[model samples]
Target: MNKILLYFLLFVGIQSFSQELNCNLVINAQQTGNENFQVFTTLEKQLTEFVNNTTWTNKVFKPQERINCSMVITITNKSGDLYNGSIQVQSTRPVFGSTYSTPVYNVNDKNFSFRYQEFQNMVFNPNQFQSNLISVIAFHVYMILGVDADTFALKGGEAYFQQARTIVNYSQQEGFSGWKLEDGLQTRFALIETIQSQTYKEYRQVLYDYHREGMDQMYEDVKTAKKNVADAIIELEPMNNRRPNSYLMRTFFDAKADEIEQVFSDGPSVEITKLTSVLNKIAPIHAGKWRSIKF
Candidate 1:
């Protein structure tokens, strides 16, 4: 009877602490020109395991409930154990009562330089900087979590964003490029800092309003949902006026431009005269897409 009770408790605990991310991690070393592909293969396998198997949050996530995301690490150069590359991180969440999934976060990190001996253990130590490889991947994982959470509830992702911030703080001492303010405007340092700043508070609020209040409601009320989504996006104009062509704004549109075009083009027309003007003002890079919005 004691053994049965112990087994029951253990099973419950396992269910309570399931991993949160279902990630499809790809390591593309085609440009490295290393005919010996064993190291790249091994690195891909180990990193996949490291990311998908690690439990990220205290909240329980069942297998199907895990956030759907992908990370592509493109290795551009290799010198001994040092590797130089870029990483593109993208994540999406399912819209309620629909078969569609909406893109939530997407960013390409260009300063992905790291050292890894083949067969090196990929462990994530949040309180300490383990390796540039681990820290970079872990940092983006929390960013994905934070952005996904924010879409569900207003500022719901704060705890996860704070974790990403902690990673930024811990990783700065390593002299890596992306962990510092001087690394350029699009670095991880700028991304997380912009996200948490009250000056850009509308960005996070739009994430919630666009997803939970807008996309999720499309099945029930298409016109109202489109208006909500447009209103949520237009709210960013004030922030753009303050900080033009900001990293967060670019990141938001990078993931959302195509979807936005599609949504506005096909939908029951909400008055978008103001929306088009706002889009051109804030994300002019996507002007071609905005122009293609039919109605």
Candidate 2:
């Protein structure tokens, strides 16, 4: 009887301490050599615990309310303590009054390289540079939060975005490849900066409108919901015209590509035509998908 009572209390204690992110993490090392492979297993376990158990923000979140996201790390090569890999980070948030959780972030980082040792703990210090593994993980965690928060409230993710920016700032001196401006368009620094830029403020507003005013209203009022989504998609035009396939622009299309196609599959011809035009100009890579939208 005492053991049962103790177990119940422990379960309740764990539930009470839930954090903002409910991240599902997976690390694959099959590509790397089989030598000393046990370290990768330890690394995977540590990363899962780090992302799930750590408290990131001051806001308390109930177990069900925690944000849902996933991170998959695939190691391509290893030399001594250095490991080269790719990180695929994806996240989705639940629409109000519905069971659907729309995608908010989808990014594939090919330049993710880090160093790890067997049973070594991953540490992240916001004010200083740490291991590339922890630094990159922390950066994406905050980015996921920022994107999710912005979907619900206009400019609601400023704090989270700022946290990401700080990670970038602190990480720049770490000599990591992805933490630099010259690392190309798909780099981490470029995307976070684009999110926080004043010039793209309206784009953030569009995110809130698209998710809250748009997706949440689909079953109840798709016509009005479609209009709201169209407004948000069109909002991408100006930013795209200015930056011409920017990191943020590209990330948006990456995450919403399927959602856009599904939502507009049965949309009106006029709406489809408008969306097709905008998509062609902003993200021509998905032109085939956009063109398939039925009138």
Candidate 3:
């Protein structure tokens, strides 16, 4: 009976802590007129297994606690084993005391090019650069984890972001488009660098305040929550003044424009004249969305 009880406890423990990300990965190869659909299908199946099965962090998360995310890789061209494509990554977190899941990270990476063979094993090694495919996917995974953590706690995503930075460092020597500083202003290097820089510290703080302190409290006290959310947006104005039209700022609004519009469109009513103005100045491209916000 003692041995049986010990085995049962072990089983329970194993079941309790599972993989962190519940990612839905899709491989779209319609643009590649290759009649060999089997390769793409197999690649999708293996990648989906790799992403969903790999344990991303030291912290243990229950099944339901897993971060909800999606990755769509659109293969634009194929030449034998070489593939050129783009990847769209998006992640969301559930709001406290509510059924709604709020978008946290959403961006499209256009520099995804890699070599792959059908049924090739996809493995991730953080300490070393394995392949462009692995490094790119792992980098985005950490970014998703980092942003999600920031929403829950102030600077909570530091460790995850560092992991992403490590991947960037290791990948730079491989001459990939998104891994180096000269790749472009909006490359993966820039995204991680800007997020970790002390100059843009307020961005992380806004994430915590906007989500944990504001969105999480909506079900309990909506008026106070709206104010908190608005204050978080206002906090970005100083940062915007210092660094206008930043890549990070654009990335933030890309994931949040619709949600921000909806948040102020209908609520207990908080003063948003300044809020809309600040948003327009910082993110002029989103002015149309801001205009739709009801006063």
lDDT, candidate 3, 271-291, per-residue tens: 998999899999999999999
- Ten residues in sequence with the least summed lDDT for candidate 3: 8-17
Model 1 superposed RMSD (Cα): 8.9
Note the clash tally of each candidate.
0, 0, 0
lDDT tens digits by residue: candidate 1, 1-295: 1221122121111121113799999999889788358989899989999999998788766787788899999999999899999999999887776556688889999999999999988888878999999999999999998998888878888999999999999999997789999999999999999999988989999999998788877767778888999999999999999999999999999999988988888747789999999999999999999999888
* lDDT of all predictions: 0.86, 0.79, 0.86
TM-score list, all predictions? 0.93, 0.89, 0.92
Higher-lDDT candidate among 1 and 2?
1
lDDT of 2 by residue, 1-295 (tens): 1221122121112121213888889888888757357787788889999998887888877788788899999998989899998999999876654445678899998889988887787666767777888889999998888888888777778888998999889888877898888998788987887788876666798888898788766656657777788788988888777778777877888999877877777643335567788889998999888877776
Number of the top lDDT candidate:
1
Alpha carbon lDDT of residue 148, candidate 2?
A: 82
| lDDT of the structure predicted as candidate 1 | 0.86
* Stretches of candidate 1 exceeding 4 Å from the true structure: 1-19
Q: Which stretches of candidate 3 lie over 4 Å from their true place?
A: 1-19
Task: Assess candidate 3 and give its TM-score to the true structure.
Answer: 0.92
